[model samples]
Target: MSDGITKIKEEFDKKVAEIKALMKNPQQDTGLLSNSVDFRDKNLIYSNSDGVFTSSKDKIENYPAKGYPYKRGVKLSFSADGTTELEVEAGGGDDLYGICTDIDEFTGMATVVPITNNFTGYLTFKKNGNGVNPGDKLHFNAQGELEKNGGNDKSVNAIALSKVHKLTEELSIVLASVFGNRALKGN
Candidate 1:
């Protein structure tokens, strides 16, 4: 009988440890929702004549010489039970520059706009543009003050975690109490 009780306790402890581990280091998945613009899709016009010198012909060249054209809507996902800090970064190829504007968090989407300041590496682009570079990545803390706003802010905050943890803890306590009572009765 004692051995059986010990086994049950061990099993409960092991399960609790697993849950704690998951809570401690939650999993996060990030995705690009949208980009800035399709530079290649734009038409560049020029006028020219065969015999006489004329304006250049319209050339449809892809911008961002290296990366894909920036789309309008872009987003990254960070998942956790509690509030988590986040950072955003961008790499400009040629004509592309860092986005400017509050990151919209309504739909977990980021709106990138063209800005004169260059962001090269890991730097915060929200408050000041001093350390900005050509291809710097932007960092967005929990405050959600970066060029993007909305969904990112909520996702990184503690609201979701607090709710989930509360429910989980309640369930755990109830389950433990029930199991303990049953053991006592059996004894």
Candidate 2:
């Protein structure tokens, strides 16, 4: 069973490579164009700035799931072992992180969007007693979720976009930025 699965995967990867090659070339042959429509419709094919063609969508990445079943919208960080492996814990000091968008249980991969400088997007955050108002400086709480009440030790640097009641499980959207020093300092 495993051998059959591996064969299927290999074939699929080969076809994907061919499709990527066709998309990269300036003049694509009609034959290669036949199977390319499906991928393009999903916005999965593109020629990147570095002149390499990849199927990865903009701002989305597939990383190996160190801990399987990462919940949708959970904050993620690169494990200490490598950059491509993802874990649910908040990274310590200067480490970059992303929000979980989806999880592929079959492949054990987690889809995430890396929070970069000036990135404006939605992230799941645990609400504090203040209930997270706009302009509140957010830092990673102990569980790797966002909270405005965090102390000086943790710094993820996300700002609340929409207000969430303290009764809610988490805040749904935030403006994540890596620039400047908007980090929360403990009182």
lDDT of each: 0.27, 0.51
Question: What does the lDDT read for residue 9 in candidate 2?
Answer: 100
List per-candidate RMSD values in Å.
Answer: 29.0, 14.9
Q: Write the per-residue lDDT of candidate 1 for residues 1-187, one digit (tens) a residue.
A: 9999999999999999988766543233122344337565332221111111112332212122111212211122233434453323333222223332233344443333323222211112234333333322222333222222134222111111011111232121000000100111100
Question: In model 1, where is the ten-residue run with the lowest total lDDT?
Answer: 172-181
- Residue ranges of candidate 2 with Cα displaced over 4 Å: 1-59, 68-96, 127-129, 149-156, 165-187
TM-score of each model, paired residue for residue: 0.17, 0.47
- Superposed Cα deviation of residue 63, candidate 2 (Å): 0.9
Candidate 2 structure quality by residue, lDDT tens digits, 10-108:
999999998887575536666644555543444243123212222243456667665542322335556776656546543323444654545677986
